[model samples]
Target: MVLNMQPMRTDSTIPRIVICGNLEFASAECESLFKGVAEVLVMNSLSSADLIEGMQPGGRYEGAVGILRQWNGFSHMQRAFIEALPSSVKYISSLGAGYDMIDIDACKEKGIIVAHTPGVGNDATAVTALYLIISALRRFSVAERQLRAGLFDASRVTQGRRDPTVRTLAILGLGGIGLRLAELVHAFPMRVVYHNRRPFVGAPEWCEYYGPGRLDEMLAMADVLSVHVPLRKDTVGLVDEAMIRKLKKGAVLINTARGKVVDEEAMIRALEDEHLSAVGLDVFPDEPTVNPRLLELPNATLLPHLGSISSDAQKLMEVRGLTNLRDLVLGLNVADLVPECR
Candidate 1:
């Protein structure tokens, strides 16, 4: 339902923008930025049904030209919801870098421009990955668990732990987050190798680039394997049992990217047999409900999808999403369009 938090201008000539989710840090900034430019309508929607109903003809958001969306308890912006959008809705500015939740195919059919905040969360997510890498390699979580259980044997917990120094760190995807992670790991003096569709021309000289054909070779040589690929049709279950077996035995695994990119069952089996010394995961295949087996593993360092929740990252994402909507309303080309839309 549309929230009448403030008086909205009735001028049909003025463009209307709807905010689908609450901004934790940038609410005031959103108001100020679009004060004189467009009529900002806040949507108090509980589910996709509410949003779909509101976007219908002669509905509350019938006149909205743009929507700034965030995670509002809905799983995705599927084709059904997209089809319900009024003809006036021309733009969708999403809050995060990943636009997998939105159906790009549907948006394309409707001629709706989609934009996402890409670089805003890179550093925050990279730092989270770096922390996981160190924690997993050093067996920090295992040590903490042992100490908490009153086992107090430092020698036992530290028996097979390894350091990040002088190790080969293989990144599966060399996008913004992966590149930032490589730079962070370089400080530890770890050798970095990245696999991409093609060579990243902007990659640092010290970073070794491995083409798609050499993915298995890169995996075999890695002391620590970090998955950074986005979740897509081709990437779901990309790192399957065979790929997990390719990694050197006892190698640490880190995944800050989407969880479905790696085969969760295969990864769990590897960890169970001690083929992987440890694993650090920030994202899970099924969020808010992690596997019970993973929770029981001492060598696993798990985070509740906190990779991009830093205060700075949160504010930047909010501002970036709002800016995309603002730009589109002003007839300016929006930046950070999703790959499919681009």
Candidate 2:
């Protein structure tokens, strides 16, 4: 795990880079971003033994673009591969803001630089959260299903949508996406409150800040709750049965954050008891395979992790990922290095 903070041999030469694991799920334009600027290699997702052939070090590939989704919960051999990368390879770039999937400690020990698209996904993801909030509040999913089932009587759909002006929105994490979503919804004159590790200084005048000690007060007061936190040890299962009990009855919950952040069974139970009116989720506890109970719930809006799925957003993320690689090749401060790495 030799660290290589020094610049690459020169700036004029094209850096040889490799795209590891699955590529089909990535943006279609991803490969073209490095055209004529870097020698690119595509490697299929394989177990440790399979990666040995044709994956040698020493200028064969000096940079790697790792798809976090593909690398989620990487195997031990994969960790070894990353740490044992050839001397020529010194940079690893993840597609988006979350680097939780990659073995960052291994990269750091190897003196490898890691970077991601920090701000590229904010707008798209915020828009998805907004969409979920509107749909869940209005119960549009239930109405659509009933309509498709030949029960088109508009009277059957409950007029349960809460007026934004009368509702209080409590944002759990006021990161990039949370701030953007606040701007998007404040037009409705919704009363906004947010809880963060520390108060967000220089916040908009309309938004209220709640420190950790005031969480119970915020939870009890919110008519709609939107979670925008990252997946970390402290946040996994952060919202559980006890926390749900604190929410306003019939409150709507929107989670565009990581699935593991909320307790799924507890949420399902609360929904079943009518304690929660509706739930909207773009992520799940076990991704690609959702809880069957959530699928059966009439009041739940489930999506296949669509936070950053837009074509435009996809391209922007790839461009940013590639740009980080370009910057490393030309010797620039890694702008989006994860805080822990820095």
Candidate 3:
């Protein structure tokens, strides 16, 4: 597959760009950015089936300049969309920080240019993870619910049992969010350790990198474990019964990354058995829908994928993503094009 790095020709046939998902928030900014250089096609999730027509022979996808995904719901359809696109589409960009929902391997195989905003939501997610850690450590969620339900008692909130010293933190897949979280948590002077597939380059002075063999060792020590890895074959269901059993009793688990990364059913069992203390999740195995049992647990705090929903991060993602797309469209090298992950 030949990759086009040169700027698309201007006054050349207008490059057709199709967008999948709702465009309520970003359509204006994106339209203003692309302006005269490209023709934009916007489709709601229901209309995506028509977009697929372009993917087939004699399809409308031929000669498309780009495809931009606003919402990450089309994982099952993404491959087909890419497959149907005419070979001329040079770039594909997602609207948010995480691109784990997209089948990047398929895009790469076709030599389609793929890019996503990273670090745009780093602080947002890091802050959310920190909140979960604190909520779990202090059992804030239970107390809040009790109060909201008018079952509140001063004694429970004041005398709730939690030993800060006994709580150890083990971060899985310590990327940008994990690293920032490590720094933020240190103000509490908490014990911090992390596990990554490869050794992190220039890890903070306070962090100790535990190799894979020592993952179990770290898990057993952790009273709180946070996950920050992307969803992939090796990562999906990375946390299972065996791994959950190793956690110290009353351990809290926080996942701000992909939901599929953790085995939801196994986590529920751990929580029910009291083997695990609490689990807080901002992402789920099946997004937009989560395990009903997880919601029933008093110890569990679940969020509707709010990690990167901050207004600031959203704006940054739009500006940065569009700038990259425009630069690439205008025949300039993108500085942060997703590098081939080793």
Task: Output the number of the TM-score-best candidate.
Answer: 1
Per-residue lDDT of model 2, residues 1-342, tens digit only: 111122223343566665544443343444455555555555443444444444554333334323232232232323677665555567777777777666777887777777877878899999999888888888888888888888899626557765566578899999889999999899887789999989776679788998989999999999889998888889999988998889999998899999999998999999999999999999998878999989899889988887987777876776677667766665778788777767
TM-score to true structure, per model: 0.93, 0.84, 0.85
Best by lDDT: 1
For residues 55-130, write the lDDT of model 1, one tens digit per residue: 7777777778898886543557889889878888889999888888899999999999999899899999999999
lDDT for residue 318 in candidate 3, whole number 0-100 = 66
TM-score of 3: 0.85
Give candidates' CA RMSD values in order: 2.2, 5.7, 5.2
Q: How far is candidate 1 from the true structure (C-alpha RMSD, Å)?
A: 2.2
Q: Candidate 1 vs candidate 2: which has greater TM-score?
A: 1
lDDT accuracy of residue 170 in candidate 3: 92
> Model 3, 1-342: lDDT tens per residue?
111122223344767666665544454677678788776555433455676666556654546677766554355435765576567777877666667666677778777777778888899899999888888777888888888888867527665457555356899888899998887888877788999878788788678788978998899888789998887678789888888888888888999998888898899999999888788889888877888898888888878989987878777776777767776677677765666521
In candidate 1, which residue pairs clash?
Answer: none
Q: Rank the candidates by TM-score, best first.
A: 1, 3, 2
